[model samples]
Target chain A: MELDGNSSRGKTIASGVIPFVFVIILMLYIFGPGSDLLDLGIPLPEITIEKIDFVDSEIQATVRNTGPISVEVVMADVNDRIQPAAVEPDKSLERFETALVRIPFEWNAGEPYTIGITIDDGTRFEKEIDAAAPALDFSLDLVVFFAIIGTYVGVIPIMIGLLWLPFIKKISRKKYHFFLALTAGLLLFLAIDSIEEAIDVSDENLAGSFNGTLLVVTIVILSFLVLYYAGEKLVKQANSSKITKHVAIALMISIGIGLHNFGEGLAIGASVGLGSIAFSTFLIVGFALHNTTEGIAIAAPMSRGKLMIGKLVAMGLIAGTPAIFGAWLGGFSYSPFSTVIFLSIGAGAIFQVILVLVKWIKEQDTVLSSGAVVSGFATGISIMYLTSILV
Target chain B: MMILVLSVIVGLSVIAILPVMSEAQLKQKTFVTHSGSVIQTTGEIIDPLYTVSSVEFDPEEFLRNFEYGRISVSESGQTIRDYTIIAEDDKIQEISPGVFFNIWSFNGTVPGPTIRATEGDLVRINFINNGSKEHTMHFHGIHPAEMDGVFESVGSGGGQFVYEFEAGPVGVHPYHCHVMPLEEHIVHGLYGVFIVDPKEERPPADEMVMVLNGFDTDFDTENNFYAANTIPFYYQHHPIQINTDELIRIYVVNMVEFDPINNFHLHGNLYKYYPTGTDLIPSFYTDMITLSQTERGIMEFEYKFPGKYLFHAHKVEFSEKGWVGMFLVNDNHEKNNQEIENGT
Candidate 1:
């Protein structure tokens, strides 16, 4: 069923794409990139050679500071030899930051070299790795691996939200106004947040570059225009455009939230890479609460008509699952510039979703008390702001 | 913007022409004096020739530096020093970090070791040919014709010879295997420091030896790794520690081949540079000094502040290619250690 004025076309595409996107994001957030859990203000000495490269007789290793506080690397060894290696910026590395340390030598190809590092705190880390391993270490702990796969728990609530569509449809018109206002509140927060995160990554080409910032802004504006046009086309094709428009706007909201969740995933992943277990735990809880509200936002937009479990599930997955993927990438591989790209596009699309809701709210002439909107917005901000304190 | 563009272009052209001013151009180019003044014409010029006579017409055999399976070190408190060196190929385990370069060194060390002496000392170096090529120890000091290692070839098939000379004028000098294709022999890592103290005795200071050499990693005839003490980024990463307000004496020799010149520039401090190490008096008090190939001298400096300072080649290309290092002067352990830990 192509989207050529077909009734079931949008349903088919939304259901399949939303679930896949949702599951992928959840899985990524849980296991993609992460550090350890620990207490507040406690510094620990830990390091990992996140990547290794041997070229031109120099062995360059990218090391992640998997610790709570700043630590100085006093010495490095290869195969028990007191090899001469130098760390850039004078070797004092902070938590979560990475640095390049290189050693020059004619290496014995095809041989495993164990790179050992000694930090000022007297803690030592040694890992045996080949010279040409890919940047990410995909090795996962058996127990933690199954636990991360369990992030599929996120999909259950999405399924439940889809099933809640029938009862949602029976709500009085005045109650629907509050739900719409609440969804808007949630999305407004996300649009701003997503935009900021997209620009936070450091890179040679993107860091503080006027052109790079312009590129992000351009992508955001273009994303909004593209989604608005496609959404407009979909609404015009159906005889029963009211319900279809609601469903279409709901999917748009989900997609936008998906992008926002990806930014959150990066934050969680970066915290995990830093080996701050307490921070990661707090972040996961905060995001999980945020994700719960997102599911309602996805469903509230579509409660105007009879929404099947399949459609609600599709909407739920579309909106809630991107966080997982964001987390994984943030943990294993994160670049502030790259993260910004996703965030900017998401922000623009989500803004378009808000515009659709605003126009719909005005067209229907529903008496939405400004107090409901103000209270709803206050609740949305307060929930997220309060949850942030747990970390 | 126009000035910036012009300066960039000019900089590029100068760097592009750096390889042109080599020994190969010495015979063809006219000498240009400072400030574009004093242009001298080439008339029916006669090149002057000079020679010095020595005590003996022939040389005597000496002891090998090391016995079988035992390392040999110079005897202390002796005016007459007997030394031995074998020309052989060895690998510097990690020349930079994990980068290794093959070297033809004395005692498996690059730039070898600093051989020190008093001016009146009778120095004898018994040279052994144990490698795959003919080699000789050419000292950049006064010696008789028969003792000059440049003209005499010690065979690789276990050939042995002796070089004996009275250590003349007090100065810092370089010694290397002076065989055919001299640039290759020197660049391939056959070099060391030879320092002779003056008769009046130099001031007591914390002395260190540095041999400035570079590696042709890709062998494109351009140095890829330029360094003092033969390790690229060695000094930059692992800075030499010095006490605040203490004199630092460095006998630095530039044995870098393929490059026409190398220099030493100190950040945050000035040094009394003694060119050729001939006199106790200083020629200039500057933060930087340049040296041609095999040119070496003693430099003295003291840092007043406790900070990590950069010591590098003023030649930007050389410094960029890793001929740079840092010096950390420690006045307080807690303060300096924290700075080092923070990577500042």
Candidate 2:
């Protein structure tokens, strides 16, 4: 009830002003000139050149900020002449952070060269190489290294899974449909994993301005639509032959699994390039274990077709060769944006393969809600989850 | 019921205002100036309010102070002034908070000491190069070719040279290190203002020197931060205190490199512009003027009201990157001076 109108209005005004004034005073005390009293004396900048290597025609010098303050590499010089250089990851190195500074200059072997780096503060630091020799590029040893990792992680695991094909031939129609459902579940997991990996790469390694997440989403959608339309057209044209339809589905599954394996290889190669992780025997074995399930997904759809040995090897090659190329690209010139784009495509392809398998399963006498199909799907996802823990 | 309803509305409004206020607090931590321009805090941890101590170079002290050197009268009734300037490249100065820059300086400071002399005076500069690199004092006004700092390069490691010339052209000019790769010397802070006053002095008020400059911290041939008198947003937090209705003359020099042009704008007032200060008569009574690299002029204006005013780069990018400042026009100069002297 309204007792005194004027006093109520005055009280309302006072209540409103009280919180507002209190907030203003609190903010001013925290952020205003009063905070200037917290001045720690100025920090001095110190930079050290950690290591220098001559790779091809370029000289890559690893620089570290040893000071309390951050340092930015502003210029690179060769024998006092300013030469354009590229700073990888970033030019600004925070305290204790290291960056790779690559300067392209053609120098003769066994010649003394001075590589100078000018920091943000106008100070030039120089590192002298007494004798310049070309360091290791994409050598035979590195190729062997990538091949061995790819064989363990990509090829051998898929070959081992293909070994199940002989045993799968004796299964009845109902049990075969269950395997198809299991393949779909495995591919669904791979699709989700690829998308997750793409998102992580975009967020961590790429610059924010590149719109990495949006790029991944768009590429995934585009790749999915294109592959779905093509797969449907192929299936419709081969409607007369059940064997052709089965073979076509098996090929699509192999290609989709191939793209996912490529993304895995990229992770392996990039980790080595960034020097954040080592290529230990345990890591290779873990990756090999994680990818063995991918092989079964490819083999499940091919059970109905009369599979020739050559056709099986061709499918295996199509799914396994991309990991090799991914390893080479990621090891040599690993850019996060490219990884995001490729992984997004892999996710889209895998999603489309899952849709095709579902359609094929529906074409059979098996119901989509059958208990066998449901259990098979669960087991498929469970296998991938268990193996991924090793990775 | 009305009081309760009103109180409920007030409570809701406070909830709405809290977020925006806290956002402003976050922006303050990011070094956004009062004029709403973001100073370059990306990849930096600079303290926006940090000013160099008195032992180091003070932009406020460098503003109005002038070096007249040792003065005497010649036998022909002419003025004689002798100045000694030591050029050293080994000095490290904290241009911005947490940002230490290698400054090639004259007498240990960037935009060096303002060398002032009257017109027709025989000005002798005893130059010494104490840097590790070649440096020479090159003045912008009339002088003999032999006395020019170019071609006669002063060697590093304690090189000496004498530049003797009669000071002419009543205006403000820049003197810098005229070494090869000239930009390297200029951008690293090897430059200063040289003021040639007329024999018959004009009515003087409060005069100061402002070097509009920028630093390319990323070595990308583009400036990462812009500033007035070396430190960005300095005058904004600590506004240049001045008396109301007083004539304030500012000698502005643009020493920004890698930038095609830079401009200045004053808020709340207009000034009589003297292009290069070459003429006694005013050129334009305007609030804004564009400057090319090394282009300078004299600005004279009087604030009629007692309040705060902004002076900053008209180019929004430059101001956003740190070239903004403020002027506090007060009626009581003595009390304000006392407060400043007490370091409040």
Candidate 3:
């Protein structure tokens, strides 16, 4: 059944509104001003830093999860600077329930410092403790945080828009081809940038016997090949079935994109985990925008087919899963090689998908001419290039 | 129609009975290794003399000399009265090949042997330090402060201390030397696994003991600067062979002087991991068990089909060097093949 125009229009508005609201709420929760409610003696869940040891520059502590349900912990150093530590939500909070957490840090000897643990449950628990001089040395940079946020919020949306324009707008075929060419250029640039970064990381290592630079390139190329074939097989299989054809196609495309997005998230997560919060933040924002545009790209064909609203929503979610998974994985595992490999794979798969989309457009005999397609492809590439420069 | 019904009934019966037999076959069994022979013992003190270090524990030596050793218990039968462990420095002593130590440990070697205690039993340990430095026993996989042997509780020059803690949960728990010079003391020799069998009941098995220990050393150096039981090593191997489809539960404890997360990989089996000390929950299925320092994990897997498989730490360096072992599965077919080949 075809989607009614009114319902589709309503959904588009809802989608835009929901994300905007969610982002605002997230910001307020993170940076909002608040007063100390504990002074009033209104008993809330208590979190105590039972022990803190600065062993070899890494801050290790045992946090007692004393609340009813699991809570997210936010830790900051003596300077009130937030420390990036991945503390998984505790599912149970029986009294004195403990979780051992470690954060890579460095401290000056004989300097007394304070650490704050903010439990982000409905009832927040804040504990400040004195930290001893560290036995090791490590530092978290702010650039990573910004990078993560920018990737999710900024770059992602623009990329998504570029992905959709060819199919969504009533443009000339030449414009579409231009958009395709533009996308190709942008992707090629990204791939090169990732390889360079991979080399830089390998170069920083001094203790290994193998040539770090060559190994990084080899792995990146291998990852790209593996992801490319995997994506192609997925698309082919999706198209094989008549009964489950559209759904299958949607899923396959989503998986490829998801894998790619996960790599981006890993990059963001790794940066933040290592105390590069600013960089991580920028990455998150860019990836978010890119993913939204990706959703549009996937939805445009389904929209043309005039599928039901529920099916469309389901397809959107499926496509979005990879980005979400990517965000989480990026935050957890901190490995430069892993991040580079995943990003390259994502770039490759997206390149293949765009190719398939162009082919599909060519086979269709519509009033929209080939010139519009070319122009559209070029536009996609140019926009990405302009944005990459800004980033 | 009658023939079809009979065949269906028979098929269903076979399917139903197979798992029960398999479960019976997989029950935990005890195997004792001594001198140069492997014996299946029922109820006697099977290889009593053992070695406990900071990183690993061997119960085979203790099992062999069980009759001579004294297992003192409290009057209530809940606590150990005089559980003595002597730590001393010695030359290369042999209990088995590739297992030699410059350190002669109480219960006899590194990771003093397995101490079997029932549920709710109180274990009192008396540790004698004959080594150059001080040391204390820390029981891992148990509850907080009460049994956690950290801080300056025991030390050198034949000092005696009593550790009283009620044991809860049933599974293989590990105890090690927790004292200053932690790395040197442990590497020299100190650690072993303690098994707390289920209070209710458990199945029987042809049990074999395997412990994975982490040690760090400058392999290039020839001087005995080797802190054997101390730092996390790149590799150490322990091999075992079992019948096809045998149920195996490996109790793994991390006692590295430095906290090193290891990925335990089994070559041909996917292990179902139980996160907590013992009560089995739906496993987080994976080949590698990521173990943190002082953490204990119990992993179970059935070698359903027969084949020789390798299981070891997936940290490539560990497997290539020495932290490696093999699992040989001998099913009916393989046994038959071997017998034919041997002309026996």
Per-candidate alpha-carbon RMSD to the true structure:
26.5, 23.1, 29.1
Q: What is the alpha-carbon interface RMSD for each candidate?
A: 22.7, 10.9, 23.1
lDDT of 2 by residue, A204-268 (tens): 64544456788888999999999999988878777766548877888898888888878877877
Candidate 1 has an lDDT of 0.66
lDDT of 1 at A178: 65
Error of model 1, residue A277, in angstroms: 6.6
Reference contacts reproduced by model 2: 0.09
Across B1-344, the per-residue lDDT of candidate 1 in tens digits comes to: 99999999999999878777664454332322212322222211100000111111000000011112222334764367777787786544445433445678775666665677778777877778887889888888888988878788988857899888888779988889889888788887888878888878887776787778887754668665677776655556556778876778888888888889989999998999999898889999998888998888889998889989988898977775557778888885664577789996
Best by lDDT: 2
Question: Against the native chain B, what TM-score does each candidate's chain B reach?
Answer: 0.73, 0.83, 0.63
TM-score per prediction, in order, is 0.41, 0.50, 0.34
Displacement of the residue B8 alpha carbon in candidate 2, Å:
43
Per-residue CA lDDT of candidate 3, range B1-344, in tens?
A: 99999999999999999999887665533332223233222221111111112223333333222211245566776444346677665534432222333553545565466666666766666667776666677876566575577874655667766666666677767677877666665654577767666676544444433455543321221111111122212122222557875667666665544436555788877977776447646368888777665566667777777767876667654443234556777785765677799996
Docking class of 1: incorrect
Residues A40-118 of candidate 1: C-alpha lDDT, one tens digit per residue: 3655466766555555555666677766567766555566333445565457777767777665545665567776565
Candidate 2 lDDT, tens digit per residue, B86-173? Answer: 9999887777644566778999888899999999999999999999999999999999998889999998999999999999789999
Distance from true position, residue A9, model 2, in Å? 95
